[model samples]
Target chain A: MSQVNWRTINVDALDPDSALNFDMSTLTPAVTPVSASEVQGLAGQIRQLLRGGDHEGALRGALESVPYGADEKGKEIHLHTVIEILQSIRQSEMSPLLSRIYQSEGGSELLDVLMKYLYKGMSHTTPTGGAKQMAPQATGFSQIHPLRTGDGGGQAMSVFLSWHEKLVEIAGPGSIVRVMCDRRTV
Target chain B: MAQPEIHHLFHRPIADHSFSSDRQTLAVARDNLIEIYGKSGQKFALQDELRGHDKTVTGVDIAPNSGRIVTCSQDRNAYVWEPSSSGWKPTLVLLRINRAATCVRWCPSESKFAVGSGARVIAVCYFEEENDWWVSKHLKKPIRSTITSVAWHPNSVLLAAGSTDGHARVFSSFIKGVDERPAPSVWGERLPFNTVCGEYLNSTAGWVHGCEFSPSGDALAFVSHDSSITVVYPTGPDMEPKAVLSVATQLLPFMGLIWTSENEIIAAGYDCAAYRLRGDEQGWQLAGSVESAGRPGMDSHREESALNMFKQMDLKGKVQDDTKLKTVHQNTITTIRSYAGSPERVRQFSTSGVDGRVVIWSV
Candidate 1:
């Protein structure tokens, strides 16, 4: 028999005085607002914990303070932040955290969401042909590199990720992540 | 994975099967007898028994152009037999070798055939003066070790020989003049890393058991005692190691290696597993694994062993007892030959050990 455990978000664990705080406004359909000063404070605290090599503690704090199973947009932002923090974890010993995420209920769905957002962010923005003559440009964000074209480099990177995802799918979330992390350390 | 379906074509134990160039008829060697069978499994009855070799025949080959058959045996004589209305009879017997003739291979054009013996020398014989075949030239420079396997390139006039000395050498046709049979000249050599068990050098110089040339004639594949298959190519300008596929854990002391196609190589070892290594794959894959059909009287012997040691109080009981050994059909697969005419035919050819059983596998 197989078992699954869904991890719960503990947003109350965040210290009120920390330098980095989770901004409530960036979350779509904002319900509450946290001052920029508070987010800066929380970020500082995270940096200090990382420098002190308290990786596990820092990761736990970040995961606990994130809102999960919220509105779709808000959930997306929260999950994105969690992915960024997990990626930043330096020590290979932090594999247990990844394993816990993989084994959690709805783990596959969460990973799917993460992959969709990552792929969308890497896609190129095309030029608009005739969109109401752009009555009033909201914010101009020009394409960065004109020479960056074609799918060769991006497709190669995607192929590698696809292979990794397929392995994870075959191994299941929990044990596969733990094994991969352990192998990385070795 | 599902196991392959095994069909029994012939119940009588056969030693080996050499298909005619057209693959319409099969030349089978069983014990001291040789029989030809048609494609329909009907005994051609063309020959009851070819009376030439005294000992059990070890290997057999059929000329590509002519339908002449060659059989080698522990009798230390390689006989060339021609089919006639009455029966198959020996046309010529090359009797100059000291050790048992292990393998015989006829060139593609059927003009010449090479025979290897335990004597470490490869003798090339040619069919000269109608109906008579004689040794045109021979390499007496005995390979530093016993020559266990020999194969001719598909099209080119070249021969590849593998020896127990952990090396496979390629030789070019040295036939000087049409009248003056010439000796073969050494072209190149390929040496693979020693076996992992560290017995590469000390192991008997007869470890090289199998050798074959790819259909393209650009590469040669061979196996050693270490259970590793090495592929060597001499056409590349730089002579780089083209490909090396290891069956280290699957195949041990492979006795037969043959190319099923340009990209697939099939090899069978002492173990019952038949392995296939794809051209693009990094390692050999298990194509077929077969356990012995059954062992007769094996259960009773084990029970007796325990009784003899405990209740019987027989202190003189031999620990390595050979008398109670089970007579199972686990003969080492000696040779594997693909169908020459139908490349994708269902039945592939193979030969075995003491029983001299010839098996046709449906692929």
Candidate 2:
């Protein structure tokens, strides 16, 4: 019961006889998804810094703004704030945020730094069985980041799903299986 | 409240968990068997395993006073386990349902048990003294979908069932011979078997995951897939409820909920945390999460070697923080049962989850 992604389920796939026939549309109304403009406004400075080719500067702001060391409640609000920014910005605008963080000096490190907030933030918001594990095959960074063409990050969950997908995609094809095999011995 | 006791028993998801009346014994339904654990000084050690069902055991309940364990499974069967001098004796129950049995609960009187099934029916089983066997009487009426949960009212005759059909309905399981005449209440006056006392569909028509009766059994609280908890206070049978307070939240939907008092409810699900909901016949609202402290490892900046950092970077293209959740239960909490207190004034409750953890927390 906890294994499948209930949200990702296509509504038409529901079997009348099965227990999974939960109408997911009930979720859509509560999702006051951070509006695109609000997201743009929240991430305005970071957007400007990235567009101006100051990748390092944008990465710094992304990393510095997070209250990683804050207490539980403070961290939750801050994470939501960061998530709001991520969820708000359009993929056209957000893709650059990812690309810049990856392209800059120690950009990979910055991506990792940024990912910490994303990961921790998601854990905070999602309910127990509600959290979904993105398929391992989809865990490729290149396919995930979409570099220029952003397709999957349209929904709220895509933000978390895109993380590992981009990770494996960046490593190219066999790296996931290879690296896992290497880690097994180490 | 002292710290919660964490028992990481195994890797398998715990379908359901129950503590003995004395709190010295624990029963957990795993894949196909119900594992019984004896609580030692502070931890539960595996004492015995009851194996009878061929398929996954979906639900298990321990009758407080009878010391009998009732378990139902995907194999379309239910078993009553009685502790004997040797170990435990298993008595087969004739559910007669074709599809998988989803959940089961013993009535407060412990004389009867109800098994909800995918066959679109609830099998109310009781011991037929003449036959000397557990026999079931089907409550098949307006149920449209698989039953996910069933909560027995304090009176034992009123049963609340939440189903995938997005409805939580109240029914009369009154057996003429077995059950005593229940006093007239807001639920109904004339009660008969399979009587639909009240029927409620989720406001958003989402699948109802959990349904529970208040301590007084006058109110019902259910959590649905819409990430909302609704409290229903009945006015009278076959009439509009006095209040149907639906408290919606932004978190993911809850898997199960329990009423601690007439005005207090605690629900836990996919969010992996239990949240408190408080209200009355007037209005109800989400109080907040029961646990506030975030996941561990997120708080501390542990120093690691440069080599370690490089290895993480080399392997995953980032320094991943793959640590367990900060909450007591690291995964989805499937069921939260009252542990240390009575229904009205519960002092502590226990939650078992997909992570195979049984955590007892103070209320």
Candidate 3:
């Protein structure tokens, strides 16, 4: 050809800025990846604590072993254990339990972990188990009834929202922002 | 506390600023041009402007000793300005990257400078005597995202970089000819080029916005987008750190931070105020805001009557003047540099912000 038509060529198409071109695996810190089995082991211990009526111990246990590097299944298991611990606490004991945890050593960090789980639990749309069934009702009505149970999703959402409200009262709005901006999966 | 010395520059963001070693010349990256201000009497007057880049100037630094002004911009280029009898002359550096350069810093030795870019690379550039111009050696491995900021170790061989990938890394930028063999330290001994000395990720995986080595170079501290500052103290080479303290704050995320002393850090960002964090290896906490609690414009003593409303509306074209923030900066402070005193004990520091003001604060 005498001359190539440069104007006809698309620049972006020729040099695409595709995400696949960049390898992000090496960018993370060299923390040992928390395996799924390790998460299971921690869940078992948390369950034992929960069965013994040690809700605080179970919550602490769950919060302490947050699998930040583990897969989705591990995170889901930890979230379930944490929800169980939160649900067992009496409504009147919520503030007292929070204050107690907040005062303990490394308590703020534990609360931060719990805040992460609360956010995870709230964003979870697909229900896990069939312990409680929720009717398809208006969003406003569902929020009005925190204890009312129907389906797993709605009740879990209400629980998460209730804890979030109380969490803000104690931890302030910064906790939510931290959880949102934090990129660690768990 | 003495009142902060404030210079209201033109109404534009100062992305980066540097003061000459003698504290007479001030170079600030104002939008697309580098505006040079000379200290005269008590105030800084506009002296000259260096214009070369076609895009926003992202970073600027004047070598403390050499007085060479190095500037990088979004146009994917960097310039080293040298002062001659005629004026300042610019020499374009060969930063063969395809993306915008975000930040730059002159090494303590003033022999080499590091330019962090959006292309996931840090170009450590130095002058090549053979070529008689500046050339760059790219640190391309292990960086996955835009490099937000870079800091040079006191030794001038080890470089600390903060990136959007949420990891703050220490790399040995030991150019064989440009840098001498640094003495053995906690970081490492045999530091060839591109040696990964240390990498610390933000606990919450927030994008690292700022990174700085301690005055002693034994510790590294970085501020992330999660509104937390994490300090890393390495024990030895190829070993776990002695302590990695992450201090979460309730205020907004800090865009820049500087180690005032070994145990103290001053950080400022979207909160429009400088906060002092104090602690040692024991623990770190948000000590307090550097700005005193109650200032003149902090109180909202507006008369809620129609007369006052009409007066305010007539004077300012608004019913209420809620625009002024209680803080001195009134906008996000982007960069905080050690202005005076040694790194061991910074007696004074300067902060530049989007509000087009450079404030010199005494510690």
Number of the top candidate by DockQ? Answer: 3
Candidate 2 or 1, higher TM-score: 2
User: List-wise, what DockQ does each model earn?
Assistant: 0.01, 0.03, 0.38
Clashing pairs in 3: A133-A150, A133-A151, A134-A150, A134-A151
Error of 2 at A134 (Å): 25
- Taking every candidate in turn, the Cα RMSD to the unseen true structure, in Å, is 25.7, 14.1, 5.7
Worst 10 residues of 1 chain A by lDDT: A127-136
Rank the candidate models, highest lDDT first: 3, 2, 1
Interface RMSD of 1: 24.4
The number of residue pairs in model 2 that clash at the backbone is: 20
For each candidate in turn, the TM-score is: 0.50, 0.67, 0.83
Candidate 1 Cα outliers beyond 4 Å, as residue runs: A1-186, B1-15, B22-24, B38-47, B130-132, B177-206, B235-247, B281-330, B340-356
Task: Compare the candidates by lDDT and give the number of the best one.
Answer: 3
Q: What CAPRI grade goes to candidate 3?
A: acceptable
lDDT of 1: 0.52
Give the interface RMSD values of the models in order.
24.4, 17.0, 2.2
